[model samples]
Target: MAITIKHHIPGRVRFSLAVLKQYRDLEDWIKQSLIAIQGIKQVRVNSHAGSIAIEYDAQILTEETIKQRVAALDFEQGEAKETEHQYTRGDVAMNAIGTLAAVLLPSRWGAMTTATLIAPTLIEGVNELKDKRLSVEVLDAIAVGLSAWRGDYSTAMMTQSLISFGEYMEQRTSRNSDQLLAELMQPAETMVWKLNDNQSVQVHSSSLIEGDLIELKPGDAIPIDGTIIKGAALINQSALTGENVPVRREEDAVIYSGTSVHEGNILVRVDKVGSEATTAKIAQLIYDSLSSKSEIQQVTQDMANRRVKITLGIGAAVFALTQDVNRLASVFLVDYSCALKLSTPVTFKSIMYRAAQNGILLKGGSAIEKLGQIDTCVFDKTGTLTYGDMQVTDVVPLDGTNDARGLLAIAASVEEHSNHPLSQAIVNAAQDNQLPHIAHGEVEYIIAHGLKSTLNQHCLNMGSRHFLEEHENVDFSPFEAEIKALEQQGRHLIFIAHQKRLIGMIGLRDQLREDVVDTLSQLRASGIKQLIMISGDSQYKAQMLGDELALDKVYAQATPESKSRIIEQLKQAGHKVMFVGDGVNDAPALTQADVGIAMQNGTELARQAADVVLLKDQLYAVAEARTLANIAMKLINSNIKLTEYINSGIMLAAALGWLTPATSALLHNGTTIGILARSLAAKHAK
Candidate 1:
């Protein structure tokens, strides 16, 4: 089906109403199909809007070509429905009745009737043989064929009925799971207030078109991508940017779909609508992450494939040597392919769902497996361990001005232009005290140091002790004892200097997360042997925090590059490290670690670079993620082992002639389904 091109850019195309319910595994199937196309870079399906977005090289795949290919593509939902119909209650009942009828009827007539009823299985088996594929269908066909030829019509009918039931159950289970995932992917619909001139109209979000003006009130979700045309509000963009806090948005600010307006009012001029929104792109990225297979999955698949081929060869060889059709059927039916292939994906995807519910988005199965193996965890101290919510605890005037508000007002004026957390904190504290903005001349911001500006025609410098005392040669001896005392309490200090002389200091305390200590203890208990912290704070402050957390190592006054080097060094020393951070500065270290976990409220750079993201902004999520990972790995390994053992027993029983081909097929199918059910039914730990 050709989908409507809702929006198009040089490398991206958003297709509306593109998803079909008939495709049971829509996300993965669409991804696999489109990703193989010559120029296609990626594909994301939004099941909620029934739309898909594709990023591709336009030079190779033209818009016309994409449309034609999409229209021509076929998915197997119809085929699955047909299969489901064949195994419905009515079919099962008829099959059971036929088996009974065949047993009670005359010998020749019963055999002939049974043969006719089991013809589809024989045909499928012949097709498998022609395709050079080993399949359980062939084994079922052989068992039914041999029994009918031997005039054991009851055995043929009963075996075919049982095999049909098992296949139905397996397919039904998988189909139901696919439906659940699709439902979860479905986006929730909401009403958007569109502004046509001075009038407001309430309409569905999907009905919104480009160039339309929309008004967002307090507690309203921004349903379309747009730029603010008027008014201002505190917008929560956590869903889009992984930021746990809401940001103030005013005129000219870009607002995205799925983010909400927390306060005030705003008029947004829509630029992107429907599937073209940023939320849709994120959904696509997430789908791509989860659908991609891990190395373990590929290895398991290879092993299963090899085993199937070997089993088929063994069956053929045994049949040629002994001329035993029943034995050959038994060997073919007892192979381990189904259990291995079905269980692994169920386990992986199920865990993905569980993690999503608990506020973690695992990039893929590989991340889950890698997380389980993490032995050392490195944390960025500022925004990661602490709440990143800095507050003005104490303000001291060194020049005996006794004007805390005046000092804060001066500091806020110099720091208001910075996007740094600490800078914002100072500005916020000043705002809380209702200090009016002071006029300041052009400001010079020194990277990772301080900002120098002309306030009241005097050279005003505001920053760290190093920036004031060492860099600017400002005297801090008068407040050295107070600085030492505050540093010991893990409070961050920002000094204010006027006319090249220290005048005041602001003591900001970034409180640790409520759950950090407990979560750290949990991680240690869960096999995280080494806990390390890296911070840009002074040695005294970093040491204080490290001591409080009881970390294994602390690297204070570390630069961004040094943080990455520390991760590399730990990795070189034979430790699987997971780095957690929340700022853009931590991006390098995050990438360098074995697994990078970005906080939900972290910068976009950190979120994009990290392998996993914590959506709840909770430090305890680290422990939760680790626990889930360990559980997933354990479940996968145990399921594989159990399947192998069960299949082995079936093979042995069949070879010894202690179990009939029919009975062996039932047992094998039962084992496979049982394992899959357990994988799907696993309860997630809190």
Candidate 2:
């Protein structure tokens, strides 16, 4: 295959593979081949564009080397690697042709033709039996084989036709559900502004390397784990911290991949790229979760396998008692294998599809099963329960010179020059009141402290109380009583000083999510027995929020390790804990709990550790997910009962000679198809 290098950079290159335009199926093989090479981090194939993009470690492989490797690839070898298990139109067409042949040909010839069509199924059953396992395939083979031995070619052919079609449909449904989930987990390719030669140039994120300076503006997701080196920004770390509020990241502050800039601009020096990036690691974790099977899935499969053996014994007993081959064939045709084996997973897939549509990503059937069983709900206070953004709650003027609005306007004027969350909050409050900006001297930002400017020739200071009192020599003794009152109320105060005298204090607090009360109420109503809250806030603040929400218990000043310990203790004390958290600190607790539910804006690691991730930024989705799980489990159980009772009745009728081999086959297959339809229909169930 001829390869043309369309673009090239240090760690990345895009090649035009014109052959992909004609042979699109070879794309996966080509990607796999490149990924197998040493130093290659990622490969993306665009068949439509006939391009293959590769990101590799430049230290190990050069652009010239990658180009040579691509040119040397063999298209014929790639074609040979295609998956054999993939269903095609030919599979369905072959089954249809065999059924038509069985119906149109002479009896002996028709039997031979149908037998050839079912040979693979029989071989599969034999393989299972050789391994000491009786499966649905075994039951299916026996039913078709007995009918043929009784000289009923048409019945055998029809049964095999139905089995082939059902199996195909099951595969297609499973594949579609898995594809939907895979699509959801795929990361969107991003481009970032890199500072090359002091000029900003847009480049693909994959091409970034350590020490490269990348500029980020409002709404741009940070594509690499790095430290901000220039400027400041209010970064929305909800994706990493699960907090609704954006935090200020200034010079030297570490910023992680998956977080976004909410306001302002910053230049970050990349420290991690490609698969080593935080979001990429999370994506890998999510991919691993897709194949995991729940205990319920295993249990249902075991039950189905056991029923196959029981069905074979029933057929044996019926034949021995009556010495009737026809009756035995009828009994064999009525086995519970088909409905019992297929419906549980079908139901789980259906519910998963529905959950995804409703802004919830249930990792697998295991997540759904565990979520349904969760009794004690543990919540992290900061990001999970409270809104991420802080709101200005109190604006007090101490000098008796400025009203609340004047004090707010003055603070906003200076704060607007910085990108801190508190500064933004004050600025936003002033904007809401339509207050004009107070003209002041050039603002000076004191990192981790506050802001300083000149208003009417006297120095104006606005920041932490410690910054004003200890550093700026501003006396706050007169407002000690007022500050303590606000502190006791869980208010974060921003002190303002002019001419070394305390002038005002602005109080900001994280607002509780409006839906939190209703969400907690719904959780309790939906069988969550103990509602607990964990927080990094002071004991007084944590307890205050706990009381407001009526939480059963509150753990204050919790570290990441302590959070996990609390979850472990809860589980040890006989509770099925569902931990809801959003921060990097919450990752341990998220993993420790029986079920971890990550908020939509939660950190990448937290989401990866979580079983259920809410795609919508809503606290109520937790309750919705719990309800959906209960509904899914209920649907699966009901399906099991329906399969058992219906198949048992059909089997008894077959044994008593109430149904012929053909009729028994039709009824049994119809019952299986009906149960499958009911399971798939659960996607629409409330």
Residue-level lDDT tens digits of model 1 in 1-686: 64788998888888776456445445555654455454566666655566778877777667666666666556653122112122555555666777887879888778767877788888987987899876555565666677777676777777777666655554444444333333333233566667876766767887878999987664455767899999878876765566645799889989887676655667899997654454433444444565568877887787787777767787778778878878877776676876777677777767777877787777778888899999999999887899887888988888876489989898897787554678879999998989988888866656567688897798989988777877889987777798888777777888888889888889999878999999999999999999999988988778878998899999988877899999999999999999999875677788889899988777654665677888787999989889888988899999989988999888877776677766876787678778877777653444
Q: Report the error of model 2 at residue 669, Å.
A: 1.6
- What would the TM-score be for candidate 2 when compared with the true structure? 0.69
Best by TM-score: 1
The clash number for model 2 is 10
Highest lDDT against the true fold, candidate: 2
Among all windows of 10 consecutive residues in model 2, the one with the lowest summed lDDT is 79-88
Worst 10 residues of 1 by lDDT: 77-86
The positional error of residue 589 in candidate 2, measured at the CA in angstroms, is 1.8
Query: How far in Å is the alpha carbon of 411 misplaced in model 1?
Result: 3.5
